[model samples]
Target: MAETGLIQSRYRLIELIGRGGMGEVWRALDESLGRQVAVKRLKPVGPQHDRTFTRVLRERFRREARVAASLQHRGVTVVHDFGEDEGVPYLVMELLDGQNLSQLLEENEQHPLPVEHVVDIAEQVADALGYTHRQGIVHRDLKPANIMRLTDGTVKICDFGIARLGHDIGMSSRLTTTGLAMGTPHYMSPEQISGKEVDHRSDLYSLGCVLYEIATGAPPFDQEDAWAVLVGHRDTPPEPLRTHRAELPGFFDRVVLDLLAKAPDERPADAGDLRRRIVLGRTGEQPALGPGPLARPATGLPPAPRAKALPAWTRSMTAGRPATGSTPPPAGRPDPAAGLTGQWTAATATAPRTGSSVPAGPPAPDLLATLEGRHGAGIDLGRLGRWAEAAEVHREVAAERLRLLGPDHPDTLATRYEVAYTLGRLGRWAEALEIYQDVARARAAVLGADHPDTFVARYEAGISLGRLGRDTEALEVYRSLVEDRTRTAGEADPETLRARHGLGVSLGRLGRWEEALAEAREVCALREHTLGPDHPDTVISRREVAAGLGWLGRWREALVAYRQVAEARTRTLGPGHPQTLAAREDEAHCLERLAQA
Candidate 1:
């Protein structure tokens, strides 16, 4: 067994992050680079298990490493290193900084996610699956716990332990007959449940189950009996999403239902096709009714096939609890630091000595770990929207970090950044603005003027200025930020486009409607090209264009823009969502103005 602390003379395992039937994941440091990484160590099977089972488990671990390392996409986890240490296999990966959907659902007390969030996740997961499917990989086990959403809003699909390459039919066949089902019962597809041939469409069906659960707080089949759940996947039709959550967008409901089609051919043709459907739906450009099986009434599903004995592999399967089944840690318990950056190590806790450029002695590792744990707790509070408590905790941690590691230390600055963020969330814009400026300057000096962290702080400062109605100051901040972002990240980069969008908003606030309209148009076109027309950012830019046109008294043109925004928002975010209603209000106001004109 791999114990805590240094392994392979390079990685120092610090704390356990997660564990499952297969193995345990640890937060560890790469002693070579002084950076943190996650190490997933395969658990050893006892002699009670057949030798073949042990061999298959090791093979799966190696396969996960190979498949994950081969993938290169923003929506997939990045594998850093993999090897065996003392007969124990471990895979090192970039430590993600946010919760998985299962954790997010648990954090929300099992309530359904916001309509917009559900749509966003669906689109992102579809895009990722499209990329993987094109590479001839099928993730046989796509579950909520196997995906992650980072703190920065990037969604990544994780774990390919059970994934299969399309070209490797021989190995796939052997693996399938190992007397174990390859997928979680709750999310398994009909073909997967029946032990039949599976393909990329199976992944789409699994994604449908995930979306259903997050959209309705329960999977399509929520029965406690494993056999019954498999039976439902194999035979029963799922209830429509809106029947459980009335506010789910109609387009979203249709897309998800189509994915849940009983036969593989009845579902969307491929992941690419699925992505296009989501885009079309979000843009309000989809057909009034989808094609093929999607056009059929939900009740028109063919009757269940005649009952037959289920595959023998299913007999050993357990009615596994949903990934979201675990409750949050009790109020006083130490929260698990699963999504933390893992940067608070002794190597990083150096302070500058008085009147010297030489670094001071490193602080105690135990103290650093404790503070890091507290910092994670603060982040969890923020995730729960307890900004007041989060602010207090971050402030305390920032002070301690500053005293121990110096003002410009990354850990100290990180805590301070959270403090500023929570302050902004609490509507203390002035205080937030002050702290953001401080952090920006510090990060620029310590990291670099063009560092991403520095840019983030500067961007937040502009947001603070805008919230305080300092349009001129906000405009200047965004103009400079746009220039820097364009130079560093390129004009087509999302961050650059985001900065330009902010500039356009500031111009409109300053009554420069013509300039605002031009900026918004440019940003909208770039965003559509780079992020697709249905992306939330692109839609926001489109709305900005409408706002600018209205401010310039071009009510006729504004009405067209407003109506498009309203329809898109309605299709993607549901008709009753606050953003959708606001868009509708804008459309109504535009009609009134056009009539007056």
Candidate 2:
């Protein structure tokens, strides 16, 4: 049991309520919200595991937690928050007063649950499974212990602890042992037991096992030896429910037996259909239990790219250890940017190109192919926050492109542009400025002076100049780019507004307070009209307006602007986001200035 202490300086631990080999659960108070929550802390892997295993486990944990928290159905347990404290990762969930089905079974001296109770659980579990499956998430682990029944008769599925996106095969394949599986063997589906691709049907198979145990006083395939149980699940057929309990409903037996089908296609098409069968079975209606209407496929956006694993050298500099599992940004500290994206997003305001561009002259195909791989490797390095290593990779790729495609070729310039980006991230402003200017010049010659790519390079040059304390040069770059962008992309275009916003920043840096304030107001207005008030870009412009107000000694107006930005960020990105924290810092600075005045 963990000693009583505060978690993340906010959740005050009251007592350890549950324990497992890999984690412990605590009843805790959310100091910020003044509410009780259940906190589950995953024990850090001991040195017994190699670094590779440890890293994989950590990534799996975080991914599952985030996926669990995003689920909004009532049949699912609520995930309030998740983060790390003192190097131990923890997940904060809604505290529920209920007994899991396993405990309920234990309370009854291992006898099957009452028939009505069994039906209710099956219905609720099926409903929850339906919701999760539609989101393309598979609960890899489903057992009696993971299904909870509240005293109010509400059943919620718990522990999405090992759940993963259906399409995520890379990590799953790595974690699978030769004979052993990720889930409990007795409850595991045949496909899962064989280490084959699993889908929503796997959940159906696991649910079948749970139902079988609760309805028949034991799992359908129970044996004293674990290996025998695995063999029975794979090769032997389960005895019909009537054999164990002659009084059980015939429809219930059919549903459970159908779920235990060896082939995925043989099971009910989805959990929703399974629930319909359970609900209608209680009525006189004939439940459509066999291969009914298939559930709608997952329509959610493709999963975001996983954060690149940190290489050995840069791990120390990447602030605080990466939690073994999903760690929510501490309250009010949302990670709003990817890698150096926050710094370069506005400066390089071009959208990613999805359509393939024909090369100027079919470039050396083999060299181009190799450069493509190297380019991705460089990007992966950057994502890991290894700026130095990323810069090196980009430099090598840029040199190779220069030799094969020439310096003026769009592909070559693109590689050089990435090199400059890494340089800027490393705070080598002077070095970055030279490369940015070179890329801008080359792009202008090849792609036209006012092209979006040309404008993007000039925008970065402006940012580099500003970083070097050369505000006049930076202002010139932004003024020209903003005018060109407004003409080409329209004033309402986000890229144009980005340039206008940069112009405002330059004015503030030059101590042109009045002009900066006006420019900030104008850009903020344009962004609000185009991007909505809650957009990250809009809030960022609003922050600049607050800065201009402070620069002009308008402390009252500055305080209000800063407060608004902070509140907006809290709503959109959560209060603990870095942007929200920055806004709070500005608010504090304004307060200090007001006191002095």
Best by TM-score, which number?
1
Instruction: Please provide TM-scores, in order, for all candidate models, with all chains considered together.
Output: 0.50, 0.48
What lDDT would each prediction earn against the true structure?
0.73, 0.71
Q: How close is candidate 1 to the true structure, as a TM-score?
A: 0.50
Candidate 2 versus the native: TM-score? 0.48
What's the CA RMSD for each of the models?
A: 28.7, 23.2
lDDT per residue for candidate 1 within 1-597, as digits (tens), equals 447767889999999999765589999999999999999997655454344334546777898999999999999999999998877899999999999999999999999989888988999999999999989899988888888988988899999987878876522221121112356778987666555567888899999999999999999999864545765676567899999999998989988988887666668888777878888888887855466533542432132221112332221111111011122333432222321233423333353446532236666668878999999999888766456677789999998888777776666888998888777655566888999999999877766677777778888888778667687999999999999988877999777787887787677667687998999899889988988877777776777677677667787787677667657766887764544544554554454354446
Model 2 stretches with alpha carbons more than 4 Å out = 170-181, 288-597
What is residue 572's positional error in candidate 1, in angstroms? 54
Candidate 2 global CA lDDT score: 0.71
